[model samples]
Target: MTSIDAARGMYFEDFAIGQELRTPERTITSTDIVNFACLSGDFNEIHANHEYCKRTPFGEPIAHGPLVYSIMGGLQYASGINDGTLLALLQIDAWRMLAPVRHGDTLHMRSTVVGKKETSRPDRGVVTFARRCLKQDGSVVQEMRATLMYRRRPPA
Candidate 1:
């Protein structure tokens, strides 16, 4: 485990390759679907109507893929990455949806550090991670890599 600060004081040196950090579990509900629909203007029938979705291969109203991505991104912020020494998100790589996320399912997310390197800038560093989003059954719904820049510990 990477020795991250307990109360939002993370620095570049605290992260390690292959460290997995899990976010708090979240439940997806019908209201969440509606609210996301309103916010995103994605009125696609499969995400809105159970009846319509039942006719499809999925057999139930599945959450929107983008909504799932948004939830995964939100989970990162909720886990204190931004609250800690976050400076900026440098890039997202290979984001892909693997399975349908359905309403009423419990989801959990984790980010595993893939690599880290010091930047040319002495006061910052770059970290790369692959985040996994999984259902309560532990099936992966989404996976992606994010490149982040964080403030390094001050030179003593």
Candidate 2:
């Protein structure tokens, strides 16, 4: 492999339609929720107040939707699918939170390469990935389609 290839992960050309990538699981903790709450300044009762949640269907504090999404992003990055080959996140479409994420719920993501488009530029392309976040019980907690720009394989 060339130095350029060694420096990068998967490139735009490396992805094919229907190709899937599964990330390692991550367990959400109360501390994660608290830290996310502090960072986002979202002190909602459903996410931060146990007593308030006790009156609700969940019966306890739950994680923020954004926090789950953020963790999914981290998981994806950790998977090294894009690594240094990623250029930019162009768009996120059809983002849906299907279920609540509670503390101690382990989650992972399955990302499928759904679409690809070659740009006019020779060095880059666009790819759309359908990302799904599932909990330990196989329940889908969230789903989204992320369109991202990526570098092409460099010349030898």
Candidate 3:
């Protein structure tokens, strides 16, 4: 995995509501599409067969929605925002695929802290982030709200 940035990650207390974080751009390649298809066994024509896709509105093969969603996880990891601070992914809410992701489309992720709450455990907190996957053209292709458990700072 290529690390886009060597920056340090933040603890739960370090995040503020509305603070945004971005991941480095990644270009979707035909190889990536093929690999995802083989791995996922989702050999749907729109994602695999070019000739079949030519008959569709897209005019060409497009990446699978799940593939794009999985890539978002990689992008978030590459961003290094959670790193050692994340405890678990508690939930994903309101996930939507708004646009098709085609091969050669460059994409990036933008995440904003939308909510935060201290947990009764004291050592952990819950944070909600609104995340979007945007194409290079600035159109949002996918979006979701994610809730995560994060490690809180130890007492000073």
Candidate 4:
């Protein structure tokens, strides 16, 4: 097996408000939708029944909101921006599904550091990121603010 160097991502002190990271795009697929449905037990017709969805405003089965949210998490990880520096996912604030995500649609994420504060604990600090999931057409399909804790770099 080939060994790959682990990425030690930025610590809390390395983040600045307005710093943005864009992730690579990924296309949604029917298999992905089915797998997510099986894993999440969300069999909503809007997400699972193409025939039923054909009558809806979206005109076809759309991906689940939580599924898209999960993909955003993956996209962030793939960016390697928080590989090892992340302490915890503190909270998700103001999450919104702005548009439908249908199979075959390509999506990508753009995350901007919107807020940061030192915690009372000396070991970690909070950082808030404004994350947007944009479609191939450049329209936003989802958006949210995620607050996370990151470890502080040790003194040199």
The candidate that wins on TM-score is 2
- Cα RMSD for candidates in order: 4.3, 1.6, 4.6, 3.3
lDDT tens string, model 4, 80-147?
A: 77888888998999999999998899999999999999999998999999999999999999999999
- Which stretches in model 1 have alpha-carbon errors above 4 Å? 1-9
Which candidate, 3 or 4, has the higher TM-score?
Answer: 3
- Which parts of model 3 are misplaced by more than 4 Å? 1-7
Predicted candidate 3: what Cα RMSD to the true structure?
Answer: 4.6
Q: Write the per-residue lDDT of candidate 3 for residues 29-118, one digit (tens) a residue.
A: 999999999999999999989899999999998999989999999998888877878899999999999999998999999999999999
Query: Which segments of model 4 are wrong by more than 4 Å?
Result: 1-6
TM-score of 3: 0.93
Query: How do the residues 1-156 of candidate 1 rate in per-residue lDDT, one tens digit apiece?
Result: 766455574688889999988988889988888889989999899888888888999898788888888887787778776676889989988999999888788988989999999999999999998988999999999999989899898766
What's the lDDT of the predicted structure labeled candidate 4?
A: 0.91
Cα error, candidate 3, residue 113 (Å): 0.9
What 10-residue stretch in candidate 3 is worst by lDDT? 2-11
Ranking by lDDT: 2, 3, 4, 1
Query: Candidate 2 regions off by >4 Å?
Result: 1-5
Candidate 3 backbone collisions, by pair = none
Candidate 4, pairs of clashing residues: none
